[model samples]
Target chain A: METSAAGLEKAIKAIKIGLSLPEQDHLHRELEELLGWLEPLLAFNTGETEPLLFGHEAVNVLREDHPQEGRLAELQEAAPNFAGGFYLVPKIMD
Target chain B: MELRKTTVRQAADAVWKGEITAHQLIEKTLKNCSVLNEGLNIFTYLAGIDAVEQAKAVDQKIKNGEKPPLAGIPVAVKDDLCYGVLPTGLGSPAFSEFISPVTAAAVERLMEAGAVVIGKTNLDDMGQGSTTLSSPNGPTVNPWLAGRTAGSAGAAAVATGVCMLAVESDSGGALRQGASHCGVAGLRPTTGRVSRHGLNAHCSSFARVGITAFSGEDISEVLDLISGFDERDAATAVCREGISEIIKAPGSKDITIGYPVTAFDYLEPELREIFEQARERFAEGGYRIEEVDLGLLREGLLAYYVIAMAEAFSNHARFDGIRFGKTAEADSLEEMYEQSRAEILGREARRRSIFGAFLLSKDNYGRYYRQALKIWEMVRQEFETVFERCDLLMLPAARSLPRSLEGESGFLEGWSEDLYCAPVSLSGMPALTIPAGQVDQLPVGMQLVGPPFSEKMLLAVGSASGSTGK
Candidate 1:
């Protein structure tokens, strides 16, 4: 697929990340080259083949509903902002 | 006390027989690690008194008449695997101070079996590239040769004798390629064989907790200790019991080994010669070798990157800097998210994430992502057909020798390095990489791949082939 700087920027925006102008340009060029390498993937006829999402086939094992002790204090210590037993985030509204 | 020449079996036996206490062994290992770390840069964090205390516990267990299989063996963990006690840097500056609340299940099992964790080793930025140069802790120098990349820090730690085994993760070919470069044995176990609990996910489907050791016997022993079902990781439901019995069943000369002739075309001349010698050794060892075709090897490489990157993009969504990692200061919520990820993630991490977003976008999802998945199915089917005729497949672990530290490799060039190992990964099979021989004084490795849950058979064959040890 063809890629452009604007299209690439839009994709990056969806992921909630920002890059400098030069970095964006470099990413676009690299993506274009990488996509070219993937061109051979289109040569095969996969109309009848189903997509394999995982490497192995396994049924998900479920556990009984139960509450367990949580490591809230230790988890909070690694966070950048936390207070009053809650994670702190920048305010979205005034 | 020469760690380089010591095997895990010998060390554990010595400890069990009272020849050496676990505490004394750990003390000697710590001293060796300190001296080696200054020059090799293999460890990012070295355990201190805590390691000694753990070893003492093992000694107490022996006093009580309990014999642990991995007694007094020192192991190193890749930084990406969470250990709770040591800060898991994930090869990024943003996470240099972040610590996991829980340890990885694989590492926990090793400790339970009497293996002491020496430290956390370095890696590529979030395990993106094969070369460990992108780590914030600086690159791990190759132990075999100076001014060369170790490919992965876990391999270097094992090769340098800082640790007897290394718990590492491999999404594509990082573990195998690193072992090839450092001249050691690395095993990427069958998907779902080992638990992924507490591991920082990069590519959920392909990413697996693997092991690197000095010999195939060590790898087999450790695999038995760690491979089993864990309710925490649903994927491990596929793992069955009796793995110990299977791995210890003894190597059989009646098994058939499949050889992919066309795949050798990708190897450099000198490396190809080494692989040929390994093939001859296998044949001389009494195993029947048969030629097989793997037409989708190159196509599998393409599909691997597409699926791996897309999964990585989804997994990395958790690293928003709010729950973990250092958050960048910004005026608004949107800017906070943007600035934090932009500043925290390295170039390769960001580049792959952005490309992943593009491939999975609505416009390109069917054109690229869906097509790659279909090709992935074909690749798996191809391997399944080949395995029907042969019990094992032998291939080169790497296409070329480790590149020099002074040279800068382009992104494509780096990706091409995975040409040989990625296809086996895409098949979701178990592969064991052992030191075949050396070229120009640099070690080369050959991998033996088997069907899913065939790790035991692979290790048995690998040990018997006489390709292990530098």
Candidate 2:
């Protein structure tokens, strides 16, 4: 079950969005190094990883706004760059 | 006797028999620590005053005609475990000033059993590296030779002390590898043989509390006191009619030993020579030797890195410059985390944390962590096959002697030695390392491994090797 090239793109996009931090570049370099080492071992599996298994689909649903209020605010405060309910970043997306 | 070489058993017996007061014994041990510790860096902190107080209490207890198993026996505590009054770092700065609110169940159990918690010993930063160089305090060198321990300094913590024994923990090859370097005895107990309530896990699946000691008697006696099941550590099994029971089962002139059929290719000539001689000795001691395949031993390191790093990233996430020790000294919260990450974390720890985060990340979990565990299960099955034919497995503790500081090798070269020992850890089997001989001016060791809960068989084989004399 190798990974589909399309699926790998989606995963890369989703992951790139999540690696927000001051040390993102450090992490980026590390990711490249790690992938360089593990990607070969992974190629055989990626080839077998695709075509989707049962319960493998992601649901594009949003949660109900039931006042699950904001620990995210406090946690965000701990991050290096946040501005007015938004986490500042290198603007990966326009 | 000089404090550096005596076993804790002899000291404890003396303290118990009113032959020496606990304070005097502690003073001698502290003196030894102060002098030898310069070369070793074993103790992260030596509690002269605390040890004196503990000694006083033990002396009082002995006078009151009550004796506990480790009563008055001096033992060094690993710096990573919480010691009530001593500071613990888990090998990082985030928790550097964070003293324990309570003792870890394992240390408490050891103290209750009459062992004096002498001082905190050094460890790899965040328990992330195979070498103690990862420690922010500094690398703990092999006491027998002046360098970072071949696999890790886990030996420097306990065996370097003049005390009878010392406590240690293993998440991979921490105990076995360190003992191999120090040329002393070390035990990696069955995973649940003790408790982890107080210890930090780099990877929960492979972690276990262990002991490094002067002799097999010290190893078993200390383990007996700490090995029982604890409610706090859910993984510990009941005092099974299991492995410990077999250790006590007796009669041992003819035991079967399993040798690594391929470990020789990885071992240096000196170690290969020593291991071959050790096998001959084992055969002469009336044990049948069998060669077996454990390709799993090689995968053990890779799998261990994946598992340990993944868990470590989680365990360390709690120290996000919030709540505890010192603040991350950043103007903003995110800056705080970056600062915290940079300041207290070492090169190995940072590398491991990033790897851990990636392995456990939403995208990579299936490919890394999950597959690693499957490999571990296969290794366990491999162990099962081997044990059916042998009473214990014997192998060189490492590929070479304790390495030098400016090694002809790198940190990975240092960790590569643990390949033989770490698999035993991943399989959660009990193993011990004893000094086989010296190689090129440094001590080398041989490891004896047994099935889960097979401490008795491991030590019986170890004892027969005549490596246990104090």
Candidate 3:
């Protein structure tokens, strides 16, 4: 499938990214070339093969669920805006 | 001090025996790092006084009769790996001042083993590209040849002796290719062998914390210290079987190294010649070499990028400026996210994020994402079948020598450089790249890939046949 400007716009919206016209044009050409390069993947017959997610097949070890002290204060130090143990964000419902 | 000639074992031994104090070694290393950084741009951040203080503590520990395995050894950390004391830039300007609250498990283990961090090395934007040119801090110059890219700053640091070992991340062969470009040794351990708790996620399935050093011995030593099961990272559950037993170096005579003759066809003439010379060296050293067919090179490359991009999109979604990263001034939350991401991410990262969204879209999900996953399985199976006959697979580290810094290669052009390395990554096995030979005064590396949990065998073979290039 060819990557159209409309499709690119929809993708940009889906990812919540804002790009200028020039950036979009550059990305369009590059993404089209990359997608074209990936075309051979479609030719391979991968039938009967299971999709490998993680490289190793280790069963997840369950841990006892319990409340513990978190690094909220130290984490808040790296935040752009934090007050009263909460991260401050722009109003969404106003 | 001629730092280039020093090895991690020599430095650690000297410090342990009190032949040289940790402070003295650290001072020399800091001086070398400063002198080299100006010309080579090897470091994104240098520890300076902090490194000296850490070394002093190691010296005091030595006086107290405690012999740490990596006593007073200097290490260069790739910027992508979180080092709580320094900024974890991830190769973006927006993160130039962002400090991680927690240190990565790998780095913490290194420190506990007596490794002092010299500084954070440069990397590609968001660690997405093989070439280190996309970093906001400027390109890391090659130390071996003028006007050539280093491909990775960590490799250059090890090559220049600024650090004894460099802890770096490899998703699609950045560490291995960079080692090839800089004439050093790099080991990308089997996925989940090392904990990924503090690494800023790229491709969760393929990205692994790896080691780059002057010799396979150093890589092996550091690998043993860092590889273990971490409760914080569930992926590391694979290491519960004990890493020490799996890391014993075996004799070369006991190993059968396999080479894919068709894979060398993708390499340039000079690089192909270098690879042949490496195979001859191994054969001369009494190791058996055989021909193998890995027919899915091209398909593996495609599937790697598709899967990597899709996963990177999901991984980077959390960088929306509310809880982490620098926020952009906007009236609405959506605009804040869009503007912050646009300002924070570099061109290559943005391109990948957009492409990732497209690949994972409902219309293309099965056509691209799911198909790539299935191909990944096929690549893994091919390796499994090959390893049943051979103990290791030998391949070229990069398709060509380091590219010229004078010209910029396109995104697709950059992807071509990873042709040989990415397929091995899909196999989810450990691969070690060591300096095999040189062509036109530039170094070329050959990769020794092995089955999962076979790092010891790979490093032993690499050390036996590897060269430390001048």
Each model's DockQ? Answer: 0.72, 0.06, 0.72
lDDT of each: 0.85, 0.67, 0.87
Task: Write the residue-wise lDDT of candidate 3 on A1-94 in tens digits.
Answer: 5446666777888778778888888888876787678888887899899998767776787788998898988899999889997889888786
TM-score, cand. 3: 0.97
lDDT of 3 at B419: 88
Evaluated on CA atoms against the true complex, candidate 2 attains a DockQ of: 0.06
lDDT of 2 at A15: 25
**Model 1: lDDT of residue B401:** 90
Q: lDDT (0-100) at residue A82 of candidate 1? A: 94
Badly placed stretches (over 4 Å) of model 3 are: A1-3, A92-94, B243-253
The C-alpha stretches of model 2 lying farther than 4 A from their native spots are A1-94, B3-5, B148-154, B157-159, B240-244, B248-254, B407-411, B466-470
lDDT of 1 by residue, B1-470 (tens): 66678778888999999999999999998999999899889988988888998899999999999999999899899999999889898988898888788899999999999999889999888888788877777788899898988998899989888789999999889999999899889999888889999888788888889999987888978987898999889888876443332232334566888999998998878888887887788788777889999888888888889888888788788778897667888899999999888867788788778888888887778878999899889999999999899888998888789878887778888888888888888898889998889998889988888887788788888777745554
TM-score of each: 0.96, 0.83, 0.97
lDDT of 1 by residue, A1-94 (tens): 3445666877899788878888888888898888788888767678799998777767879778899777788878878889998899988899
> Which is the leading candidate under lDDT?
3
- Which regions in candidate 1 have their CA more than 4 angstroms from the true location? A1-3, B240-253
- Model 3 C-alpha lDDT per residue in residues B1-470, reported as the tens digit of each score: 35567667777888888888889999999998999899999898999988999899888888898999999999999999999999999998889999999999999999988999999999999999888878888889999997999999999999888788899999999999999999999999987889988998688888889999998977877887899999888878878876543443345566788989998898778778888887887788888888999898889988999998988888888778877778899888889999998887788788888889988887789989999999999999999999998888998889888988887778888888888889998998999999988988888888989988888888887887788643
What is each model's TM-score for chain A?
A: 0.78, 0.27, 0.79
Error of 3 at B362 (Å): 1.3
